[model samples]
Target chain A: MSFLSVQNIKHSYFTKSTAVAALSDISLEVKEGEFVSFLGPSGCGKTTLLSIISGLIEPTEGRVLLEGQPISLADAKIGYMLQQDYLFPWKTIEENILLGLKLSKRLTEQSKSASLNLLRQIGLIGVETQLPKQLSGGMRQRVALVRTLATEPKLLMLDEPFSALDYQTKLKLEDLISATLKQFNKTAILVTHDISEAISMSDRVLLFSPGPGRLHKVFDIPDVIKNLTPFEARNHELFPEIFQTIWKELESFETFKK
Target chain B: MKPSKNNADLLHKQYVHSLKREKRKVRLYQLLIFLLFFTSWEFSSKMKAIDPLLFSSPSKIIDLLFSKLHDGTLMENLSVTLIETIVGFILGTLLGTLLAAILWWSPMVSKVLDPYLVILNAMPKVALGPILIVGLGPGYASIISMGVIISIIITTIVVYTAFREVDSNFLKVLRIFGASRFQCFWEAILPASFPTIISTLKVNVGLSWVGVIVGEFLVSSKGLGYMITYGFQVFDFTLVWLALLVIAVFATVMYQIVAFIERKIVKE
Candidate 1:
């Protein structure tokens, strides 16, 4: 049994006048410690698919599985980092990072220490007293990432987390995150439209079609950077080639939309 | 090239010069404008250009203030008025916050209560004085009930809107984490709405005071409002003016306290 599995999922939205089909007959598997990216054009429901897998939205058909059992919201073990950093502006940095822990249960002294250590590891030493508004954009996203990680979910779903960042900061965080995920040995699926980001960040990339989103193509890219961080993956020769291929997929999908 | 006392004098002169330069002339302007206003009123009253009894010179009002101060009853009545306002304001704010939490918990309850709350708020608080006096009796109870009626409604509307105005994304964040509804409220909604709620309290201080005074005017026998009414009936316009000024001063001070609390609680 694969560590994570999604099978024949279908979903739709009903407006007052029309039913919009977002996903159709989607099936995929993610093994332990593998990183996957969902690449698609705009309106392709990639985010919706991720949302469904996490059980934030109920899929209209089929099931998602963790270890071949039907995935429960409790058992799904996924942490989401959204496109925007939804940090509570009123909370201090330490409090913000501890949010998931606080909600789930009271953190023990050791666990709280570990969270502090994680914050230090994220290169934000002595910033615990600052509020979200005091931090730069990059720092806010870093705190957000740690908040998700603090939940200790087995599968991390990143919903275009770095898109809000500038180029330099994005590159820096990609390195920091990639290294952190490796050290922690996490399985992750990232939804992004950036071809280069997908190529640089994932072991496999699943490209989806727009609207009634279906898997258009899948690329096996483990060899691009065998056990290296996302920063190192950029230097691999195959990275650019994969980037071009995803770009073509997007172009064709747009044409299909038209 | 010895340093002389003249140099010390020059430094002192410069310091005084800078003090005068920095201290600003705005208060002087205000005092002058105020005196000018009353000067014209005094001049007009002397000339019989306007009715002396109606316009009432600043000097006459000052004399009235002194008389009331000497009597000590004005301050006692003022204290009574302030107590009603403050108690009512605190009660109203607490009730409003509680109601907001209830609404956040169950949207349907909020929806059902929505129209009724609007109607309740729209009803003139002054008109309720007779009914309140019948129910709660004719003193502080009626006065506080009056303030509570108006201020609680203000708080309810302000806090409810603030709670609803919180970014929907915060809700999604909690859901993604699989936080239960109550947990979501504790973790996200409460903290998010806290600032606005506190600011609403600051805003309602003045209104609540207005309510208390109006309540006192209708039925209170020992408050500043009561004194004002008594003064007006006895043709003591100066006493009435003194009462109004005292109420204004107390209300402003209470409003400032609310503002200070708001600054303390609101992070950004």
Candidate 2:
């Protein structure tokens, strides 16, 4: 059985005047420990879909299933990190990292030691004293990632987290994330407009149609290697092929001006 | 030839920009203006156009200030006013900020207190001067109460507005983590509201001064406000001007301290 399942889910928003459909009968299955990417253009409902799965937004129709049972939002195991780091500016790196644990009331001495070890593994040692504002953009995002993952959710949602960074930093973060996720053995669903990013990071990239987004295609990436990071995979012979396929898939999308 | 001419013109413009007065030079020019202003006022009073008794020549006001300083009266009065203002300001800010937090913490509390607050705020707080004196008696308590009345309203309004204006996007992030309300406030609302809080502090510094001075005017035997009133009754224009100068100087100094604190926090 799939670790998590979304079966024909629909979502809409009513703006006091009209109902606007955001997701039109979307369905997908995420296996245990799978890295999934919801790839689409800006304004696509990939984020809205992710939100529904994360239980931040309620689906209008259909049900989300976890462990072969109907999933309540409260019961949905999700760790969502957004584009903005959302690191409390006042908090130190240690405080910010433990924010999730603190909120979840799971910050025992054992978890504290484990979290600190995780931080060290992620190459952030002695950042306990530094405030989020004091850290670089890349470092802030790292702290945010740690904060999200501290709750030890079964599935992690990445919402364009690296989009805010410049190119070099983005590449560096991709490398860091790959190592951390692999070591921790976490499942993830990444939402991104960046084609190359989706191709590079994800095990399977789910391409979606433009607004009222529905999954158009699912590309099973076969470029898996022993311990290849996002930066290292750029040199793979299949890199260009995967990028081109997803590019063509996106370009074929119908564009009608609103 | 046209291009060369334009380049020459550009070079000239750049040269002029480089030669433009520095910020410190602009400050010097301001000082000069004050000196010129005082000199002119002294010249005018020296002339018979306005009576020296009525206009209070800058030189005479300086002499009056020196004499008051020598007598230790100016420092004594100023210390009393400063203490009252500081105590009142701190108390008002603490009360206002706590109340704002309570309101933010629970909608029920906010709803209950809102009407009463509006009515209290709408009434001229200055009108409460007599009541404050009656309740607190004819001492520094009356002045501190007045200052508190003025400052607490501002602190409440500024903090309440800031409290309500919390970023909902952060709330969504918190919700995803199943964060409680207390945790959300600690992590998100408090830090986000800080810039607003600092700005309110700066504004309140001035308002607190206004409150203290007004309080003094209502009832006091010492302080700059009292001195001004005494001068006004006895027809000592120079003394009145001196008192005004003292208040303006003290208020500006306090405001600068607030600005300094803001700078430190911003750096942090």
Candidate 3:
């Protein structure tokens, strides 16, 4: 059995007057410590898929299993980083980082010390006593990443986490996230629109087409891509070749309907 | 010094000198405006351009105020009204906030109560005085009740709307962490709505003061409102004008105090 399994998930939005399907027959299996990316255009239900896996949205027809057993919201071992850095503005940075621990009743002295160390690792040490508003955009996003990591979940879900960042900050954060995930040995599923981001960061990229999104193709990064940071992955000899191939596939998606 | 640095210092000095002169002129104009108003009124009354009996001059109002002060009538009545307003304000804020919380807790209840709260707020509070007097009698209870009735509905509406408008993304953050309903309210909802709550307090200050005075007009004999009623009955027009001036000053001070507290709480 895989570490995480999403089986034949179907979901729809039921407004008062109409039913709109969002996803159909979606299935994926992720191994322990492996990183996967869902690459798609907007409205492809990539975020909805992440939401289902994290137990935030219930799939109308399918189940998510962690280690071959169905996982529910009660067994909250799933960490999710949203598109926005949704840090509580009123809370101090330290208090925000410790929120999940406090909620789950696992906030011990040891966990807090570890969180502080994690803050330092993320280069957010001095802003612990300040509110989220006091930090710049990149710094606030880094603080959010720390807060998600402090919980120590089994599977991490990132929904367009770097989409709101500037190009420079996004590249830096991709590096930081890659390093942190490797250090923690975390299995992660990232949903993103940036094709290069998917190619650089994931073990396997699942491509989806919109209008009731379905997995259209899957690409595995070469073994040579291993152990290289996202930036290094960008510079690999095969990088351009692979990027062009996927770029063609995505472009074909836009032209196929016409 | 470099020539550029010398020029920069001269420019800074000129800017500061102009700013100081402008501020001085503004202050002088403020005093002059008040002086102009009072002097004209006093001059008009002395010349019989306006009758002092009907429209008391500033001097007559001041003299009446001094006599009321010496006799201790002004202070006693002023304090009585102030106490009533403050008590009513506190009670209304607390009860209104509590009701808003309860309503937020259950959408069904809030939906049912929505129309009723609106209607109550729209109803003229003056019309309820006789009914309130009949129920609570002619004392502080009735007066404070009047204040509470006037302020509570609006406070509840303002606070509840604030709670509803709290950013949904913040609540989603807590939900993803498996926060319970109570945790959601305590950590996200209440703190997010704090600025709105303070604004509601400012609005309540005016409403509560109006309530207390209106109640006194209907039934009290020792508060500032009672003094105004008495001045009218005995044809003491100077006493009426003096009491009104005192109420205006008192209300402005109270409003400033609330505003100061708001600044301290919302220090952004």
Report per-candidate TM-score of chain A alone: 0.95, 0.94, 0.97
lDDT of 2 by residue, A77-165 (tens): 67888998988777788887887777777889989888887778777889988888778899889888888777788889999999999
> Ranking under DockQ, best-scoring first?
3, 1, 2
Could you tell me the TM-score of chain A in candidate 3? 0.97
* Residue B21 of model 3, lDDT score: 100
TM-score rank, highest first?
Answer: 3, 1, 2
| iRMSD for every model | 2.0, 2.1, 1.4
lDDT of 2 by residue, B1-268 (tens): 9999999999999887766756668889999999998888899899966788888898888898899899999999989989998888888887888878888999998899888888877877878888998899978889988888887876887898898898787887788878778877878887788887888888777878888888788789988778888888999889889988888898899889989989888777
Candidate 2 chain B worst ten-residue window by lDDT: B15-24
True contacts kept of each: 0.53, 0.61, 0.58
Which parts of model 1 have CA positions greater than 4 angstroms off?
A: A72-76, B1-25, B42-48
Error (Å) of candidate 1 at residue A54 is 1.4
Q: Candidate 3 residues A171-207, lDDT tens each?
A: 9899999999999999999999999999999999999
Question: Clashing pairs in model 2?
Answer: none
lDDT of 3 at A256: 83
Q: Model 2's lDDT to the true fold?
A: 0.84
Q: State the DockQ, from 0 to 1, for candidate 3.
A: 0.67
By summed lDDT, the worst window of 10 consecutive residues in model 1 chain A runs over A68-77
Model 1 deviation from native, Cα RMSD in Å = 4.9
